[model samples]
Target: MASTAGIITPEWELPAGVQARLTTRAGGISQAPYDGFNLATHVGDNRTSVLANRRSLLRQLVGVRSVQWLTQVHSNWVVQAYGGAVVPVADAATTEQRGLACAVLTADCLPVLFCRDDGRQVAAAHAGWRGLADGILLHTLQQFPDPKRVLVYLAPCIGPSAFEVGPEVKAAFGWASGDCFIAGAGDRWLGNLQRLAAEQLLASGVRSISANTDCTVMNSERYFSYRRDGDSGRQASLIWIES
Candidate 1:
């Protein structure tokens, strides 16, 4: 993987043919608020700017032919990506085809990438608290032939210190969540998205797990956080197999 500015390549021990990268809020022409490198078109960023930024991102992806973008709805739905302009309405996508990138957009929500040990299959998921509680990661893992051989990468997201949730949110995960939640003001709880995701993946038999804990809410200069900035732009986490 080439180390490019404003892009993060996972440091996990992935197979030879797998490629992955996560974009930060940098190196784009978007104006203030949306600022730079906003990849999501659903947000209020100008359509032209969003497209320009996406094209710029595509150029950086060396061997990638096309990226599968999704219209995320915070559900557990996972689809087989075929690399086209048609945006599927799903939170996660998987692909066995080379050069077809599977991608998910997020601001503060956790973005998880998956690839088999042999680098034959890859997937990406957008996991918010609701999606996690609803089993988004598990659903994505199901797309693979064997969960045990899949390598998982947890990208930057809202950290425990910054993600305050209500009582219902904590109740959703029940006792399996363990110390992933800490007592907060009133009936709120400070939740750790990455920890919750890791626990879920481990429980599902996935052993190779790596994470980037750079909290999006805390790193205003490098990330976009919806919880921090209401109308903020989104970054993308993508994975693919080389052609």
Candidate 2:
């Protein structure tokens, strides 16, 4: 229930010794456009600025040992976060080891966090439209011991009212007549990614679910949105096991 420097701690009823944080576009030293706390290094921000922002964030995380960031190619690949410090090119990461962090960077994409009910494991995934439709969350769930015992948190992202997509996107999920989409202009439709994610999680036997209802595209002052602003810094959503 702690909120500081635009960082949002997960509001879920999780197990003890597990921690999660979602950073907003505040509290960092990045300049215009990326004005607040931009933690991403690949979004045209100065390397020094990005490093400093990261340092500022890491400082607040009192006992977190290390964070494992991924390349995030928008695919369904999931990897273990305990494989040293080399950042892997994957969409999701999981870890059973204590002190290791599983992290994901996103501007408009969903940052989903997972932790076992027993507090023995944690994971994070970058779930954009492609990744979600391609089964990124499913892949992440496979890494856990049991889907029923895992708690999931869907971090902020583009909301249904602001996320209009082409027919292909809707067709990808095979939901010809579901609440996940609403008819839009011509061949386009307003899609609800969060609802789709929830449905997917339910189909995969995941029962415990929580979500951040904030919309990145709608909340310009608090979040960064790649869909709203073409060139923007990405926010980070991370989860870790306490040592």
Give per-residue lDDT, candidate 2, residue 94.
93
Residue 4 in model 1: shift from native, Å? 2.1
Candidate 2 accuracy as lDDT? 0.89
TM-score of 2: 0.97
Candidate 2 residue-wise lDDT at 179: 93
Q: In model 1, what is the error at residue 208, expressed in angstroms?
A: 1.0
Model 1 residue runs over 4 Å out of place are 1-3
What lDDT does the true structure give each of the candidates? 0.91, 0.89
In candidate 1, residue 216 scores what lDDT? 96
Clashes of each: 0, 0
What lDDT score goes with residue 130 in model 1? 93
- Report the C-alpha lDDT of model 1 over 46-87, residue by residue, as the tens digit: 999999999999999977989999999999999999877789
